[model samples]
Target: MPVDAPRPSAWRLLLIFSRIGLTSFGGGLSGWLLREFVQDRNWLSEEEFLNGLALSQALPGVNVKNMAIWIGFKLAGPAGAIAGFMGIIVPPAFIIVLMAVAFSKLTDYPLTSIALAGAAAAAIGLSASMAITAARRVPRRAFPLLCLAATFLAVGIFHWPLLWVVLGAGALSVAVEYRRLSSGEGI
Candidate 1:
């Protein structure tokens, strides 16, 4: 498929993306976000969703939020973007604020700390699940594997600065893409 722009209804987009934001627990919402909008719903093709993901990660407050905004803008222009952004943010923000207020009073109890510890563990599991999902999606190529290894070494082992790691990985990715393009291979 050519992967042209999508034209889903405004309300539908708002409702679907909003549901994603509300239901997504733990920290790996981005992968779920991708699956919902891209694979399950077919609102966006893989390439378009991947492009949006890249852009979202590149310039973002949050990856999922940025993705909603981008997809909203693409679908229905500025109004769609606003609807998507507000839909995703408002529900979560309201719930989080309420939880924070409740937790502030509850923090004195030992059970609250235990519950939080459980939540943290669940969050880690969710993050790992997301990583596995994303790894499955990554193209099986030497350069991408090399980049992944370097990233792991830089951030995981060396604990290098995040900016440097990102920059280095980005440069390597660009070089790999350029080489692939020159070789008449699919991107």
Candidate 2:
């Protein structure tokens, strides 16, 4: 979508975030956000959403909270950020507390572990979908492709610390891209 695409009202933003928060389980909330905002509503373009997702992941807090605030602010300004924060945090907080209480009692059952495993599988699928989408947007060039593969190998195969892999790969990618752009090669 364009920068001037219609924005949602704060209330609408709140409701959307709240629904995701309440229903979302396991991880991969980012994937769900990408689907809802980018695919379903066209409230944000894939690039815009991906940028925010990157920023959110790099930031110091919970990725979901950061994403909620980022999307909320993008769509509805400060009030939207507040609504997003509250909607994502509050309802889920209550549900988590309730689940915690219930799960404490149910932990003895094999079914509980099976149910958790199912949720984890679903989360992994969502995450993989988002990863494929992001990977598809990577420029089909050698440096970008190398960085992608190297990062995958370093983190996924070698079990390098994620922070170090990201910092190294991200810095190298930026430097190469900057040099290319400066030399008019990319242009």
Candidate 3:
């Protein structure tokens, strides 16, 4: 569902991610990215952004960073990926270092702590919105729905190790899809 977004130069990509990195705090960076790239800019479809979100979650390292690279690569290429990666990572890295120094004193303040808690709560709401948006797009099929529920149970409820859950569930899901495809069921 990728539409023709005016191709942003690498510098422009960096500027965009830099804006996100500079402003976003207390988490929910992916939500900001989703709004920026998908809903606001139409740089990518919700489906593509959701797919990258899945990969970013599955792979090791930072989810937002991975998503930045994924979006950048999809939009431009390797250079664009680098632009996205550095744009998100470098700016935030510096700001976090600076904030850490300042935050030591801030942490002792009750109001500061309260404000941070409120921000965290808001971030969770943002994350929930993103999850719901992605969930709405899942195909209406028994196996896929089952896989979604099982994965949720394993990770969210049972607190299973993500590696095992992903490997086992992914294999099962792939097998099911393969069977459907082979049987001319059109996965």
Among these predictions, the greatest lDDT belongs to 2
Clashing pairs in 2: none
| CA displacement after TM-score superposition, residue 72 of candidate 3 (Å) | 0.5
- In candidate 1, stretches whose alpha carbon ends up further than 4 angstroms from where it belongs are 1-6, 114-118
lDDT (Cα, 0-100) at 34 in candidate 3: 91
Q: Each model's TM-score? A: 0.79, 0.86, 0.88
- Please write out the lDDT profile of model 2 over residues 58-135, one tens digit for every residue: 889999999999999988999999989998999999989999999999999999999888889999998999889998
Model 3: which residue pairs collide?
none
Residue 65 of model 1 has an lDDT of 81
List runs of model 2 lying over 4 Å from the truth: 2-5, 152-161, 182-187
lDDT of 3 at 111: 94
TM-score of 3: 0.88
* lDDT (Cα, tens digit) per residue for candidate 3, span 120-172: 99899888888788878877888888898999999999999988999999889
- In model 2, the worst 10-residue window by lDDT is 1-10
Q: Cα miss at 93, model 2 (Å)?
A: 1.4
